[model samples]
Target chain A: MAGAIRLAAGVVEGSRAALSRAITLVESSLPDDFARATELFVELTRQQARRPTAHALRVGITGPPGAGKSTFIEALGRQLLDGGKRLAVLAVDPSSATSGGSILGDKTRMHALACHPSAFVRPSPSSGALGGVALRTHDAALLCEAAGFDHVLFETVGVGQSEVEVANMVDMTVVLLPPGSGDGLQAIKRGLIEHADLIVVTKADGELRAPAAALAREYATAMSMLRRRWRGWRTPVLTCSSHSPADVRAVLGCVRDFHATALRSGRFEQNRSEQELRLLFSAVQGELAFRLRTDARINALIREQHRRIVGGEVAPRVAADCLSTLFVERMRGGQSAQ
Target chain B: MAGAIRLAAGVVEGSRAALSRAITLVESSLPDDFARATELFVELTRQQARRPTAHALRVGITGPPGAGKSTFIEALGRQLLDGGKRLAVLAVDPSSATSGGSILGDKTRMHALACHPSAFVRPSPSSGALGGVALRTHDAALLCEAAGFDHVLFETVGVGQSEVEVANMVDMTVVLLPPGSGDGLQAIKRGLIEHADLIVVTKADGELRAPAAALAREYATAMSMLRRRWRGWRTPVLTCSSHSPADVRAVLGCVRDFHATALRSGRFEQNRSEQELRLLFSAVQGELAFRLRTDARINALIREQHRRIVGGEVAPRVAADCLSTLFVERMRGGQSAQ
Candidate 1:
């Protein structure tokens, strides 16, 4: 209990080491750590409520696996730190279904940023349900803000669903694209492109410059055709080269502009509320999924109904009726008339 | 109670007019009617268990607007009826977000097929949640099969999330495509294309025949690269024209061949159980969503948390924690300790 208080205080006082420890506590699967982490998170939120924050720029970078996300973040992080802004970087490695091993070999890739003061970089695995990991990201971002960071960058590898998740969690989303034809275009989901505030053509160095510019132009045209869901903001496509620090700074410049527009239009607060509501709803859904899987009677009832369904004797609606009935009854710890 | 029993009896006894009435009952939005309809469904399911069935073939057809879905289904229905198989059709109107109104102007489009002795056609508007429509579709299909139909087809418009819902509820999924540049390709989501069992190029008339075949070829090449999730079955692409009755029969033939392969490979029962399991999970999740929306205290708590979050006084994870807490406490009929 005392440890949790110190940890909370340390995080609120901008102790980077304490921030890392707090994240570890929250991500820990142990029940004790989980309980303590919840307490810390609540306290931190209350503290956030009592004090005004610097309104940190929360930006997300997402793309296909080989889109050079880490290198680009490192370059961007250095630029922000040089501008005298405190920054925190969090990397979410996609959960591999086959190996269950995280691809967060990201520390070495961002070695300089990791060593720099006024900058903190952490790479974490998706240790639980996707929603759970998302919730953890939310908690970690708050922790960074409480730790006095003026900017928080969320980096993830993937195209479709993860892009949507990170976009919901951040102020602005930047989709990194590689120079190519339909091969890369197809990999970048249309849904991802729809939500992007900025689409960056990565690896725009040396031989890839011309194709990257062409790809950016193609993206610009496609984006122009899409009616903007948000008022007063249109998604733009840009080319950036990690080799050129100027290009990295330009990406940062565009993000600042987007943030300014969001603030001016009040979408900044609107996005935060929407993101919070989404997390709240999903958390309830996740809890219910937990109940469905963990409840002995409910699980047994579903299996029995599924068995009858497989026998071609029970319809899905009937099965749904029986299961919902059993689930509610089981939750109430009451016996059914049958 | 007597009315529900009579309706159940009428449906099971294969009275076409009674079958339509029973569908109307289950699809009713009134609470009392919903209760009666559920009773009717449970009884019908029990009766179905006691009797022997032909194990109806359930197929799902999905595509973009104007993929010739209704016309092709009408033609296919005639072929199936000619083969002495009873058929039932259900059309799920896309939610009003995109098209604003249903294009399932199916009544006139399928006038002949609807008049056939061995076929039943029903078009349902998305009156509630998509899951509600899906569950109603499940119940309606059972009503038809209980009425002795040997084949059931579930059809929906668009290639977004709703298609995935229908795909989960049916045994075989048929994705329809029109011959075009990247329009159709962009419409088919990556996840949807991965699970497709058969991809059909529609509108293959005399002038469009060549492009249709080429589209089929392109789809075949892409499908070949996808690893089939179901054992011993590969997704195949074919061309069909509504003007040519033989092409209609050929789609039926291919579907039968795929169904036979699934049965021979033991995937038929496997698919049934998997599909049933998915429905069971979604049913629980849907109920949870319903509860979240309806419960006063939970709703109030969520709104309060959302307001705090919007004020930037709370983080998302903190908001989720508070909402979940109030929900549980309210479910217990007690005030939160805080």
Candidate 2:
């Protein structure tokens, strides 16, 4: 306990490496390591300063492959850097080879921004968690804020629901699309259209510029039809080209303006609190489900019922009922201690 | 028990209303009604025909909201009707205002097919399930097949993960899009490109026709990059304009051909069985999680632990371990019989 407290104190004193290591220690999903992780987690939480840093704007960007999302982020990061704002980029990629591990290699795709002194870029791969958002992303975002980054952008692999979770966690969800009006097609896949704060058309350089602008206009129209009213903010559909510095700056300017308003209206704190509460529930639900699945007796009963249900020995409803009753009895008997 | 046996006997004789009612009874999330449902389920399973009628093709269609999904399905259903093929449409639209319950009103959107004599349209709104596929969609599909429908098309509320679930359950997943091209921008959205058996560019009717065709070719190239091959089948990208009957028929032909191949290669049975197994697990998981959450002692402990962790008094890992241990002990104590 003393060693854990001392380690947490080091993390609190702006030690980036220590913070990173601490996060890794805490985020482990392994069953055996959980005890140590919990002890450290308690220390880290208690010792961490409660003082709020100057609020940084959190922007979540998501889309599918070839969506130019990394390019857009790099372009936007440069713009932020040019404005003398410190920026942190957390890029989450798809799991490679289905090994239940992430490649965490978006840094290679983001070259220029990574070279900038004012920017810190980290790429994380999807870890078998239900949306692609790394479970650590939330804590990492806070660490980045404490590290004095004025802006934190979370880049997600283009699977839509993961982005929605990202959207819920961040202040703004900026969905990037390549040139042309094809974005309208993507709307069908994303499912949660109402959550998008902004839609930017990327790769708008050269001849694609005209079409990109047209696509932006088309998206604006589509978004309006979906919302049907003046929301507190109408999602802006704007054209941005990574190859064009001026256009990229405009996207950053829009984000700055959004943050200014959010902070002034005190909406930012409210949003964060709501997100934290949601995160707690999501985590607990996940833990409960995982524990139930790994239970030996319950696992056997579930499998037996599944077989019977499949074999026509029982209906799914009956099977479910039988299982539910057994579970309730288990709980009543205090048999869940491991 | 006798009543359930009688009811099961009625469903076995191919009573449409009885089958529908049986599914409704099974799908009920309530606990008390479950015993009766199970009793009936066992009997129905006993009489489940080894093979019902001739082979029926099950295709899943999913995309974002304004992707003209309803319009496209209407066109596809009309094409099947013209060819004198019996078609059944299952629409999962579970988005609701108060509870997010899907209105399941795709029949209204698909006027032509809804009125067709040879077509049966059932839209089931999602009821809090993560994926847009209805919890009982597999059962419903089976019932539809028993009712003599030669084809079952499952339409999901597209948001990539849900769409993937739908695709996994069905023989084919048709991903619909609007025309135009470019990469990286659209890649951020969740569901679009992955698990797409065929990429169908919708709205190819008007001035967008040429560009739509061009986009189709682009998607064909993109699909090649997404997955080299899936289940020993090469993915195809097709173009369709809901306004064009010929284009619509082309899509139907693809679905038919896919179904024929799946059946011949025994992939169809394998897919259906896999879907059933998945359904079994999903039911068990969902029920267990729900019960654990609502359990009084568990819920109280969770609340207390949450407060302690949030207050920085207890480590999240420690609290989780303690709770998990307690839960396991409770389960083993045979209170599960309660």
Candidate 3:
């Protein structure tokens, strides 16, 4: 109890070392540690999270691997810190084998940014998640706010359908693109493009600057055709070089403008509500699937049904009906009559 | 009733014109016509679809819109025709206002194949689906099979997340890719790729042939990683040039091998059963959501809850819980206690 109280006080007092240790504790997987972590999680959710005026903006940055996301984010972190804002950067990398889970070693990739006064960099591995956003990214973002970080940035590995999942959690989504590669535009998923609050053409430094600018213009024109689902705000495409603070500031200004507009129009709350429902539905579906898979009787019955189906006794629809019925009954704690 | 009887008889007798008309009727939205179509569908499902042994091998071909899907499928159809196989192609195109719904106009794109004796091409526009597959693709596949097509190929507009929904219903999935694009291996989505029984690198002609072959090799290597989840057969990636009949034959051979393996291992029934469950879940979710949107009392309660949520009196999760509780209670006609 004393240790827990000390940890709580350390977090509330804004000790980076203490916060880092707390996050490590949260990410730990050992049975006893996980139980302790769950206690911390519950306490954190109860005590530190109830801020009325001190809301933190959640930003999501995603691009393909090898797209220089770390470098750009490191530069962006410095820019934000210079403006006197505290930032929390969470990069979700692929899972680590040593700990048998995510280590979040993204700080190793952005070494200079790690030592910054007003920034925290945490790398959470993909952990074989198809949707990319580590399940803990949401909780970590809230914790960063509770720890008084003004801004929280989530960096995704930018593979598969994970970008959309990140979009659901953030206030704004920035899609990073590498320059000199014509393949950049083609790789931008329609789903991702639609959800992006801003598109940034990165690596706009050197001889590739002209091509990057051209790509930015192309995205700008393409975005014009997609009708904005959000009433007042239009998704913009911009060019930036990690080497240039001016370009980085311009991107940050866009983020600020989007947030201001969203807050003023009540779209922010609408977006949050939609996200909450989505999370709830996703949780329900995931839990339902997990329960169905783990129920020994149902699993065995499913196998038997599959065998009967192969032997040509039950129709596919009928077998599905039985499963759904069983799943519902089990959810209700027995195979009751429907 | 006589008209329905004639339609049923014509379908059973494998009359080409009758099958085309039946599909047209099924795709119609007119209320009275839909009533008749539903009756026809029920009769067809009962009498014809029960014999899974006689069902056509339903193949789903999907990729990006401009990936030359129609041309490639047409070429493949011609090859199958020459080999004495009757081919029925369902092209699911995005609905354009000027093109009218359910176009079926492939004459301009594949003029030669349209005239082939053993080929029947029907292009149905996606009416309301944001995902690539037309709303009618699944039922159309069933109708085509009932009409005696040995092979019913569903050519979706592209490989978006929604396209996987269509692929789930088909017996085999063939993901088409162009050569020289770095996205070859990146196209392997966890949800979609596992369903992709065969991967065909299309447009592998002229300068692109070498790169296409390389891409195929990369896809095969990537597929090997996923092979652990795959039960018995390997998901082979083959290179094919639509202009080359031999390349087309290679793709055809892969399909035959996949089908034979599925049948021998009894995976076909297992897959179909899983698909049925997914379909039912999707249907229920859709129906419930639509009802929630349309029902006045529920809609009113949801709006009221949203207003409360925006005012910060209630957390979004609690609001959702309340709404879902109300919805489920109303859906069940107040039988269960809230």
Candidate 4:
């Protein structure tokens, strides 16, 4: 408990090492670490309430593989630092849950930003359930905020549900697309466009410039037909090239405009509160599923039911009812004994 | 219990009305209906064991909206009927869960097939949790098999998880694509191609002929790049105009050939057994989630935790842990008291 309080204090004091340790603690699935992580969060939340720091803008950036997300982030992070703003980049990579290696927020991919005194870049947590990884990323973002980062960017691959998960945690969501419109088709299929607050066609320079512009126009037309996600704001489709400083600056300008509009409308805070509530339920579901998978008696029951189902002696639904009833009964017995 | 036995016997005797009632019984959520449904399934399984009926072919058809799925099914059904086969068509529409109106398996949509004496068409079950709807669909297919339907077709929209659910319940999965390659992009984005056992480009006639051909070629090339899903079978990409009898026959031939290969290799029965096991686990998960939502004490605890979470007074993970522990304790108490 004392260690957790000290770590929370260090985070509030803007200690990057402490913030890193706090994220590691939250990411750990060990029982001891989990309790400590909870204590750290309690302390940090108390500190936040007492001091009431400036509201940090949380942005989610997602795109298909090879969409130049890291390059764009490096450029944007440098621009933010130059403007005297502290930035933190945290990634949510579902792929890491299987491979135990993340393809996002690698220090090497954003060397300049990672080395910058005003910047912190954390890779996705290594191997765990995808839900656990996402929850840990959410905690890591909160730690970054506690460390006084002015802007936090959550980078996720748009291939799966992770992008949607990241979008829910952030105030604004930006989707990046490649030069060719055909390549952007997956983003549309994944319904990323619907969640996007801003869209960017990266590599909009040299030979790729025309195609990037064409893709942007196509998306713009598509967006015009769909209902607006945010009140009084149309999702902007823009082109950006990492090589062009002006292009990078223009993208940052659009983001700032969005943050300002959302804050002014009071939707930013309201969205955050709603997201917290949703997260609470999601966490509960995850816990229930975890216990169902891990508990010894439940495991035995599941295996027996599974055999009967496969043998055609029992219907799946009947077996499911049996298991759930027995599980609840066992839980009740434990409580009464206590 | 006597009524359930009579219904099960009627189903085995190939009575369509009894089959329909059995489906409704399985779909019902009422406690009395649930018990009746379990009895019906148990009796049906016992009858099935005694008879050891012929293995019926279960095929799943899925496509994005505007893919001419109904027309294709109608054409395919007519051909199968002419070949002296009985067919049952069942749909899994997630949209119907919200609208209470199914967009698939409408009698009007497949008028000729619906009017045929040898065919049965059932719409999506009205307004239930998606898992419940899916489970009911699975049971309906089983009942159709019991009623001596040689071919059972499960149709679903390609937009969401329903297609995947339908695919898991069937022996083969057929994904339909519209003429234009652009429209087919969404199918690829959803990873429908990976689950598909066969891919078809619909409306291959008149002005759309060339585009349909082009789309088929595009998909064929794309599938060539992907690793084969089923051993000894490369998913076929075909262009079909429902108005052409030869095209319809060609598709049916392909489906038959795939079924033959799967049966010869002993994969067909193995796959069915695997699917049954998976269904058992899915049912358990669904039941657990349902209780979490409907249980009064659990709901109250969730509301309290949600409040604390939104107020930042408790971390989501911590709240989840507390709720799960208390829920288990409560369950134990109830069992002990009983």
User: Can you write out model 4's per-residue Cα lDDT over B66-100, one digit (the tens) per residue?
Assistant: 78888899999999999999999877776666557
lDDT score, candidate 3, position A227: 91
Colliding residue pairs in candidate 4:
A331-B331, A331-B332, A332-B331, A332-B332, A332-B333, A333-B332, A333-B333, A334-B332
Per-residue alpha-carbon lDDT of model 4 for A1-338, expressed as tens digits?
78988999999999999999998888886867877887898888788788866758999999887788898999999999999999998877767765577766454578899899999998766666323765677788788888999899988888766677778888999999888656446645347887899999999999999999998998899999989987868999999998899999999999999988888998887888778767766776676676666766556668888788777777776677777666654543333222
Given candidate 2, what's the lDDT at residue A158?
53
Candidate 1 chain A weakest lDDT stretch, 10 residues: A329-338
Name the DockQ score for candidate 1: 0.24
How well is each residue in B109-168 modelled by candidate 3, as lDDT tens digits?
Answer: 777667877777776543543111332565576667777678988776553454666677
TM-scores, one per candidate: 0.65, 0.58, 0.61, 0.66
The TM-score obtained for chain B of candidate 4 when compared with the true chain B: 0.84
lDDT by residue for model 1 (B27-68), tens: 776766666777787777666667755668889888877677
- Winner on lDDT between 1 and 3 is 1
For candidate 1, lDDT tens digit of each residue in A225-276? 9998599989988999988988998888998889899999999988877777
Can you give the DockQ of every candidate in the order shown? 0.24, 0.24, 0.10, 0.30
TM-score of model 1 vs. true structure: 0.65
Error of 2 at A268 (Å): 3.1
DockQ pick, better of 2 and 3: 2
lDDT tens digits, residue span A148-231, model 3: 899999887565556877888888898887766545546555556777899998999899799999988988999998898589
lDDT-wise, the better of 3 and 4 is 4
Candidate 4 true-interface contact recovery: 0.57
